[model samples]
Target: MGRTRAVALVGMDAHVVEVEAHLAASVPGFTLVGLPDASLAEARDRVRAAMTSSGLGWPQRRITVNLSPAGLPKAGPGFDLAIAVATLAGAGVCDPESVAAQVHLGELGLDGRLRPVRGVLPAVVAAVQAGRHRVVVPAGNVDEARLVPGAQVAGAVSLAQVAAAHGAQVEVPAVDPVDPPRSPEDTPGGCDLTDVVGQATGRWALEVTAAGGHHLALIGPPGSGKTMLASRLPGLLPDLDDAAAVEVTAVHSIAGTLDPGTGLMRRPPFEAPHHTASAASVVGGGAGIPRPGAISRAHRGVLFLDEAPEFAPAVLQTLRQPLESGELRLHRAAGTARYPARVQLVLAANPCPCGNAVGKALDCTCTALARRRYLSRLSGPLLDRVDLQLDVLPATRAERRAGARESSAVVAHRVALARDRARARFQGTGWSTNSEAPGAWLRAHPPAGSAVRDLERALDRGLLTMRGADRVLRVAWTLADLAGAGRPEQDHVAQALALRSRTAGPT
Candidate 1:
């Protein structure tokens, strides 16, 4: 008898599973136990065929493979290599001690070749966190596994290579790691903010939202540069730091969208799913084990919903939880999986169904009720969670012919400086941005005089909900950070109120 280790992934979480194999003299058969899904239960046939194909004789005896922590639900074919290694060790094919220390993650082909599996980065991280130092993964996933620091990762091609590494005498062809193909969208050269001709208010709102990590909504006609402004928001933000980069990369790895060649995703990810996407696709859910959706993929970045009203109301409402908690908890019959979803949400909507309600031509054919209902698709509660709501009117001829506008690099520099000020103000407070600071904290340490009076009046008049008041306060603090003020002033509060007022009718 012998045992080895493997990782089981439920959503982005990785659980260490012990693979124990026992050989007994009896009828030839194999039994695998543990709460394995259909794909994992089929590993017996894969292991048997792979070992035989590798010229290693199967022990013609009753064999039992038990994946310990047996109550944990295990899915996917990532356990094939671990089960095979443990079984081979029990059959006296390799050194048992050598196999026990390593965590194995890979699928096995019928021909003994190792196949790549998803969630390698998180799995390796789990193994290292569990005090296991070494990991064996598929050659195709070597680069992804290497992203986790301080873990000794070895990439193998076939079962023979794994066995040979454990002191079994076997010869196998070496397989080199290749760069995973990058999609056209993944390639850089994204849109630049300077390309936008006008709509200075919309651009400014975008800057403020980027600076404070606040959510925003844009209402405009079709050609009013709404999508252009939303697309360029990512460019004006800073790159991810080391911890954030790993967290973002792990989400992409679990979603299977990560390119193996690209080691760490330094740039903040931008996910713009079509309006026709389902609630599950936007929030993260599937059949057996749920997978990360666009929201989770947009972790630490932007989730832009262009033509926001065209999306289903139910789907749009599902974002409320993640927007508030900064995490998504998905419950399945098997178990629950949680993914970090601290995303900056951007929503762009046409002013009306006819797309001509706000333009100069005034060609809107829809009646008053139609226009109201069209904008009403975005429920009040959802819009209330949004901090900055701007009406993106079309640029005038003079505005289009104005002098050269500021580039993304210039705006990003300002944003970084403002963010640094916020970081300094929030040092040791466990809050990074003005938006992330708790409302209770802001209430106890309220901003200076007359500014709070103005907010109190707005609240008394019902122009702002209690939640809306807190958001306005947050935006005020962000404005203060931008101006390098010690605290929010009356002018900053006034600006934030003006921005909030724009959302009253249309958004």
Candidate 2:
């Protein structure tokens, strides 16, 4: 008998799976039991070729390898190394006890080399949390695996090296370590706020969005600085705390977007998918099990949808669930996977299909009906979930030439201060921003009677849904924080109502 440990990733969550092997004096065949996806099931040939290349002869007897917790669906080639090590132990080529205590994670190449696999960071975290701190990963993943505190990590370059480390008398070959891929911010042009020349309303909305972790929508024609404002929103946000850093890093690891060499991701992430992206790619879907989508990758960060109207309606509608709950629940045929999706969604769109419908509509080409249908692509329910909706008007030449409008650094300072106020206000609530606070909690701690009057009237007039009313209150609280007020006053509520009711194009 031989046994070792590996991690099976289900969305953002990871589980430690025990890999056990049994040898019998019967037909010389290899049998892999337990539920493994197609990629994992193909590990048989990979392991065989790797062992043969390493001079580790295959067992002549019937070899049976079972991934315990047989019901847990395992996928990917990450389990190949664990399977190979366990098989060698059962074949008596390596001491079983030597490998059983360590968690093995890597893909076995046909040439006996160990290849780096995604999700090593989360796997190591799970291994350490499970009280099994010893982890053996590929050289390329060593930096990421070591990020987990109290984890004993070893980087092996080849199968022979791992086998030799586990008491097998084998000569390990020297090979170059695999390098991790870089994850550039995808920030085209630049990521500075000053690049946005004008649109005072747009900049103010961005500040409020960042300060409270709220969703925003910017409507206008082309070259209106919508994308520029949206991209700079992440800059105004503060760095991720320790807990959030680990969580955000884990999501990127699972999504294969994190660069392990950079260590933990401290800055907030930014994900902007194209409009033509399918619902599965945007909302998190796959064949057997679903993986993290753009929203999940943007966890603890921002998800910008440029050209929002062009996106599939199905894809846009799917965001309503995560927006309401801050969690992505992807149900597939095999199992259901959950990922954190507490993101600030930023949307930018043209007022008309012709890209010329602003101001007096002098240059506009689309008909009234066409313009109405254009903006209507963004559903009312979806818009209601958004906290800030502002139109980006064409910047005047004077505004463009204005000397040094507030830079990202200046605005980020104010945003940080405002966020600090909100954090102190909700100290023990486990929520960091105004947007995250429960509506019931907000109602429980109402600001003032007069302040509530206008909001109540809006609700009574049917202008605001029950959900929209709560969101308005949240925005009012954020406004109060920005103004250094003790609580939202009538003026703050009025401003919030105005910000919420503003729209572009027809409606």
Candidate 3:
């Protein structure tokens, strides 16, 4: 009789799974059971090959492997190293007690070498949280695994090394802390507000949006620099705080978007999915278990929906909840899972399908009705949540030939200063930006006088819904802050309201 212990991961999360091996008198074979996915079920072959290559003989008698906590669905080949180690320990070939307090995670190759596995960071974090002080991971994942501060992590190059550590002394190599590559903002893309040439209004809108973390939309014709402006946004935003950077990196890791061997992502992410994306891909869904979609992956960052009106109506509608609540819920028959989606949205759309509706250099081919139908895809509910909307015009030929644009660093400095001020003003409130302030807080601390009355008047005229009124005020406050005003003024309110499209009109 032999018993061993391990864990199984579902998604990036983990749970303890004891892999118990029973050597019984029967036909000589090996069997694995307990709700294992295809990847986990195939671990037997890889484990066997690893053991054979490492000079350990396969247990010839009838064998049964049981993964405990049978209710949870286990997936991934990450269990290979654990399975191999447990099998060897169960067969009495190695001492289990030697690695008793450690959580082991790694895939095994046929030649006995340890291979990198996905979600190593999350697994290590889970192990630390579970009070497991030690974690044995593959060498390639050593840096990623060490992101978990409290966990004592070890790196093994091969299953043979891990096995050797169980009996005779074997030294696992220490992974040096290699700083992850800095974000594009650190290097500073040469684009700048000044380079935008004209469209001063568009640039101001972007500045305010950055200061307040507000969602924005840019409607313009081609060559108007909408995409160019959108790309420069990341540079205008402040560097992510430590907690935010970790979470951003975690999402990228779960999505397998993290660069190989990268540590933590220090800057906020920028995710721009194509317009043709399915609702499942944009908002996250799968037949088995839902995964983080573009919205979730953009947590603590920006989700730029370029060519916004070109997206499917269903997909565009899916963003309403996440835009409002900073989280998205995927409801499946089996369960409901939520992912963080506190992202600043930047949506760019052509004012008309023809890309030249408002009398640009090109003649308009699209009828007014056709243009209205196209823009109407963004439902009123969706547009109401967007805090700022700006109209962009094509840059003049003179501005284009000026051959100079402001560098990202120049705009980034102002953005950082504004963010610091907001943080300082809202310290201890859990609301760092004007856009994040709750309606209750805004009302209680009504921005010094007639602004509240003006808002009430607008609400009375049915110009704003309850949610819309709140978002409008939030935008007003953001506008005032950008001008260095002490409080939101009537002018700021008017500016915010002007930016909002009427519910009855085409968006």
- Write candidate 2's Cα lDDT for 135-253 as tens digits: 99999889889999999999999999999988888888889986665665564424788778877778888888899888898888898888888889999999999989999998888
For model 1, the superposed segments whose C-alpha errors exceed 4 Å read 174-189, 359-361, 503-507
The RMSD (Cα, Å) of candidate 3 is: 4.5
What tens digits encode model 3's per-residue C-alpha lDDT throughout 1-507? 444445554544566666667776778898887854666666889888878877777888787877777777765327777777776676677686765556778888787778876567766766777788688888777888788789788888887788887772433333332232222222224556665676656776777788889888888887788998887787788888888877777766656566655578887778888899999879887764467789988898889899999998888888988887888777664345567789999889988888887544358788878888877787564666688777777776765576655666776777777777777878999889988988897777666577778888988999778888878788777777776777789877777777665211111
Q: Candidate 2 lDDT (Cα, whole model)?
A: 0.86
lDDT of 1 by residue, 1-507 (tens): 979999988877888999999999999899998955877767889999999998777999999999989888886438999999999999889899999989999988888888888788889989999999799998888898888888999988889989998988877666543333343356224688889887788878888998898989998888889888998888988999999999999898888788768899898899998999999999999987888889999999999888999998889889989888989999998778889999999999987888888745369888888898987888564677788887888788998899998899999998999999999989999889988988897887778899999999989999888888888889999988888998999988888887766743221
TM-score of each: 0.94, 0.95, 0.87
Runs off by more than 4 Å, candidate 2: 181-190, 447-450, 456-466, 503-507
Which pairs of residues clash in candidate 3, taking residues 3 or more apart in a chain or in different chains?
A: 192-406, 195-405, 195-406
- Candidate order by TM-score, highest to lowest? 2, 1, 3
Give the Å error, residue 108, model 2.
Answer: 0.5
Structure candidate 1, residue pairs in collision: none
